[model samples]
Target: MKISAELRAFSGRLGHDFARPELLQRALTHGSIASTTRPDNQRLEFLGDRVLGLTMAEALFSADRAASEGQLAPRYNALVKGETCAAVAREIGLGDVLKLGRSEMLSGGRRKEALLADALEAVIAAIYLDAGLEAARGVILKHWADRLKNVDSDSRDAKTVLQEWAQANGMTPPRYVQTARSGPDHAPEFEITVRLDDGREAIASGQGTKRSIEQAAAQALLDRIEGTT
Candidate 1:
């Protein structure tokens, strides 16, 4: 099957020429635009998530022969997480080729983190199906080479790092409390305070989604904890 010039360009960007061009098309198609004749990427995304994890795990294991599983696990997670996949998708301009429904397009589905990440994973699965493990690994390693080089020893997010520290110390998980919220509905600023079981706490304020604000609070508390250690 012949694909559009845009998809042919996307195939170039993805660094994989398709033997089964339909696979590439399905990989770029979202559920919103799926029909009886056209399938979505959900199944592809599911398979691709495992493909990504395995590729990253192998890369991390090989890169650090002396590192423990604990160290490798977080680094592996940091590499394959939705945020990281979305970043890679953006880097490759995957959003420009995505096929979305009208509502999804209007809501900026192409720019949505979850959508981008899922689509990227789907694309990986498509590559694997079209070629083989080596081909998929080559693509993943090529795209993730820089991240592999620069990944932190403990690449987990601040919240996860803090939670694990608390657990290791036999303390309950850190809790985030929202003290205040300001600004209009569309754009709001939030103040969050993260408190540990030991009564130690730190405050932070940010403007974004609630999760980002909570992360800021957690990072503040982690900074304080690390400073004294």
Candidate 2:
């Protein structure tokens, strides 16, 4: 089967020329616009998630022989998290070639964090299916080259650290309340206020999934509290 010129160029950007272009097509197709004839990338995403985990696990283990499982876990999470995947997706312009439905397009589905992340995983699965693990690993490492190189123990999620800080201080965990949601449905910007039981709070806003922006709020709050200490 034939793929579009746009996808063909995207193949170059992703550094994988498809032996089976249909897999690439399905990889970019979203559930919102899927049908009996054209399946979405959900299955591919599932497989790709595992593929990514295994690859990252191998890379991290091989890269550092002295690191413990506990040390490796956070770094692995840092690399495989949705935010990292979304960032890599943006770098390769995966969102630009997505096959979104009419409503999704209007709502800015292309830029949605979760959607972009899922599509990237599906594309990985496609590459794996087209060739093998080696191909998938090559693509992943190449796209995530800088991230993998720079990932360290300090790469732990900010949300986890913020909650830990609250517990350490004998205070209730920070509450993340969505104060305002604006923009279209698929790509809304959320304003989240992270408040401590003692009434200190920090507000932050960004476009993406609520959880991602909540991390931003948590980081902002952490910076504020820690800076004052």
Cα deviation at 43, candidate 2, in Å, is 2.0
Model 1 per-residue lDDT tens digits across residues 166-221: 99999999988899998765456789988988999999886656787787788888
Q: Largest lDDT belongs to which candidate?
A: 2
With candidate 2 superimposed using the best TM-score fit, by how many Å does residue 91's alpha carbon deviate from the native? 1.2
Residue 120 CA error for candidate 2 (Å)?
A: 0.9
Model 1 / residue 107 / CA error / Å:
1.2
Predicted structure 2, TM vs. truth:
0.86
Candidate 1 Cα errors over 4 Å, as ranges: 160-209, 216-229
Per-residue lDDT of 196 in model 1: 88
Per-model TM values vs. the true structure: 0.77, 0.86
Q: Provide the clash count, candidate 1.
A: 0
Please give the lDDT score for candidate 1: 0.89
Which runs in model 2 stand beyond 4 Å of their true positions?
A: 166-175, 184-187, 195-201, 224-229
Q: Give all candidates' CA lDDT scores.
A: 0.89, 0.91
